[model samples]
Target: MREHNRTIAHPGTREEQMANQQGNQAQGATKKRRTFLGYLALMGPAFVVGAWQFGPGNLTTAVQAGSRFDYTLVWVIAVSTILMIFFTDMSVRLGISTPTSLITSIKGHLGKWIGVLAGFGVFGITLMFSVGNAVGSGLGLSLIFGGSPVLWTVVCTAAVGFVLAFRNVYGIVEKALLVIVVLMGLAFIASTVVAQPDWYRAMSGMVPSLPPGSEILIVALVGTNFSINAAFYTSYGVKEHRRTRSDYRDITLVDTIPGIVAPGIMTVLVIMVAAAVLGKTGAEAGTIGALASVFTPLAGPTGAMVFALGLSGAAFSSMIANATAGGTMISDALGRGAKAGSPTARIFTGVILAFGLAVTLTFQASPVGLIVIAQSLTVLIAPLLGVLIVIMANKTSLMGDLRNKWWQNLFGAIGLIAIIASSIRLITTLLG
Candidate 1:
């Protein structure tokens, strides 16, 4: 007997070749199983993006929303998270089918100049936050150890950058950062529980509306915090998770749920913690690192350290994630993958350096200021990215059956409007 050679065949066309129909089906089933699990595993990194959203920025935004708006704006996070799921699934769908980052897709659909400008602008926004991350970490060090914040900040920048610089060998970095995010969650959860917040008021706030003379500044702060690059993380989560548009719809839904929920829950935690204590104490002022001024009465310096440590980890993970996302965008946008040093690796190196620049210079302990700059950039870009995606996803010639669904478009429109209003307000507040 002679051994058989197989020929690849197109579906439903016998003349195409002698490919095994049953075998292909089995392989696909197995692959789908793996992909579902992989998406779950990939989520740890993806959620890092959301974890960043909860950082020191939340210290003011969530608390302010709770205290001033009385949870009136609390629903915004839930709304935004849902919109993000819709928008990001579309992003991943476009990415896998088109095999491009959201940035590259925008460039391809629009023009190369837009792509170039977007690349530079996003990195610029991320750079500002990265600086905030580094500065925040330094504040953590200064508070914990009673040392020079600047010197500790430089050490942190050098350490995180040196680690990120490796790019490929970063499981240690990932695991360590994850631990920090978890610790951060535990500290906050414990504080909120101990403080015993008015869950009733918190729940009521979720009805979603603006209250008159309700510390509009704080409402703006919530908008600013949640508005900016809030979706940027969703894009990064999709890419790093490797969920090209090819995921089983069921799996995509599962993944999107966590990606959105984690941040939403984080939003609730801060509001609870802030209202439980800060509301009781009256108006308060302190840098994010110094949350002890408020929380210490509830948990003591030990508790404060735990809270700061958790927030710091959340912030650090976010910085690493954005850095990774920016690196990914650069590689994908310019068709610049690792030919020699590898695009991911090269970009990671740049990200580490950018961290130093953002923190050592522009960023500080003021979570509000850090979030403001980030939101401002987002307002400018969100609409463009939204329109670009809607156009790209709808082109039957480009995406065929993979175009975004009607609901996806509707949610995306909502996100766009929210960001637009947030942006206009940002400009008004900045100018004023």
Candidate 2:
């Protein structure tokens, strides 16, 4: 009886220990998952900013660069993406440090006129890029299903308008952009794998070299990837998410990593696929359709389908975000709320989309020409915006302990230099 009682007691003890151990492990896993999800939540705004910047213009530029110069221009994409990280980080910091939107901060620091002018500049830039978004969305639809670009353009414009018309625009926009970003990531990864690019050449391409007549393509790449509007829009996004300076600034900065890296990876993959499939064959991607066709020969029907899907996702995602940026900035500039769901904001967004659709449909402008013009405009505007952000960020009164660090200022200066150089080159190209 004694032995039986001892055996039972010992077994119960071991069972309780096992159960406790299992409970601890489970708790740890749950905690980890929660932490991961928290980080992902923080990533929402950065992802949208990235998606907005990566749009159809970026796709066209990458395709052209790869098809034209093989992997030789990959270094430009790399450098530009790195610069974006710095700019975006500064924007994020600025957003968190202040209680209001970026335009609002500019208004307080400068004057109402400067703020209004900045708003108009951003609005114009967004409108210019919206043309590409319209073209891209239309092209994507046309590629997938037989239809007129005009019909699809109108349809896409209406669809974006419908989405923006909603009262809870920010939430819907963020979630939609996240979905599109995921789709883009998967489609591009699949396409890149199928292309089987020359690894040796691709690696070497990371070394910077300006092949003759590559200046325009280089500037286009930088302009699209390192978008000034994206940096400006970051503050609104952070505001929409309600992140404040009291939060973990370091973690907030880290959350932008996926957003920044995803676009760069997508660009690189597009370049590689183009280099592998079109570069050798000497194919020209003067239009989005031409770019899509390159995937067919390399990866067959399925690859082409995937590329079209990714392009559409990118185009549509960017269209929504670009319009939102335009509306949000203008509305904020006018002292209407910056929240995307506000009626004033939606109206402005509609106006920008309407203008873009009208221009795209009426003029039937060359998509490539539109992209170049938009990029040049961005080059002209980015320096002023960059200077504004740097100055605002360095203000001790505004940023307090969270002001720009030595390293942040250093990178910001470098980015400014790069932007100025690109602007000069673009101006020279247009003039001469």
Candidate 3:
């Protein structure tokens, strides 16, 4: 133990360095295993792609699909879900290659102008994630235990923030959200099974068709929810997990599959419920509250209670996701990660929550408000991200040998076109 040590700045032996690298890589790989579970056991910390898709916004989409169009737009969600899967694969592939985030990578690859535009688009996503999650949480809390919706929302957010503020927030959030999603998914599927609608219409839904003039809004709405952004977030989430190129392909499957399957299944169940229950009534009801009311008489008090609980969970989980992504985006934009209870971190969550709360509290708007904005914004972001992904994937150095398959590119291109077309329709409707 002689202290004749080397204090000089000197490189370690090559073997020593390699060993350290391998050790670090092993630690990272362990984290990756947890990350894989993170993909499956999605709860409160971050979001699972479909988790947002099935939230309060989806309630609106499902309700309207039945209230207005019957199950004519059912296929929209199906088509969008598959597209989301494909695009999510592309995003994970590209994001894993770049050191930056999915958004930053898009910025780096796309020119300044395009990058800047996409950055603005991320703002809209911030709003969607924050408001969506908070409102959903509040709604879930309200359903589970009756209280002021706003009060419940803030309380739930604070509670969640409390958990997220802790060191081990991931597991808690993951388990809770997964339970919520499973509960919601099961209940909705039960409802769908209980009431089987016309298979003919459900099948016909897969075949895309433009309805009469303004009626196309339903299709646009469905398209909006099921589109590319779901996949884009998956890639971002994968990167957040610190996965490598080897993880890319599998990550895409693990991430996008749930995102696609959950929402797509939920979509079918919602459409089935609508077609069976309210297709003839043609109710203008678009809120989760309305669904609860409907369930009360039809399925009884328990049904209403459970449905409300699901809605609340959907909204709250969304808030968690929104805050997580929004905070990350803000920090990334400002070049700071949302670590613990920093002022900048709280602000990231707070800013988005305030924006959503203003709309919800002011107009007494329902979750549909998030959808109207969220979907439209994604309509823009999805296409832009899709194109950027295709571009990035084509660059051989980025993807290396495991670049985009021919089919991935084809789907990516189709997704871009679909998103752009949906954007045009959304804009036209807004202008008119």
Per residue, candidate 2 scores C-alpha lDDT tens digits across 1-432 of 998887585545334434533443344343233366676677677788889988988998898888888899999989888889888877887776665678877876677788888888888899888898998899898888868987998999999998887778998998899888999999988888887889899999999999998988888888889887787788888778766544435345556777888988899989988888765556766556786787777768787888888898999999999999899988888899888878888889999899889888777856557666776778778888888888888876566566789998998899889888889988998889
Estimate, for each residue in 1-432, the C-alpha lDDT of model 3 and write its tens digit. Answer: 232243122123223334533543454454345465664533222236566556666666676676566667776777777777776667666655655565555444454456556545665776865665666666666766888777887677666666566544434445566676778787776656544567777778777765564256565565546545445555556554666644544555555466467767776677667666664334544555665666655666776676666676677666655565555555554545423234565666567767766665665555665656766677667667667767877765445555787887888777777777777877787678
What overall lDDT goes with each candidate model? 0.58, 0.81, 0.61
> Which structure is stronger by lDDT: 1 or 2?
2
Q: Each model's TM-score? A: 0.80, 0.89, 0.79
How do the candidates rank by lDDT, highest first?
Answer: 2, 3, 1
TM-score for candidate 3:
0.79
lDDT of 1: 0.58
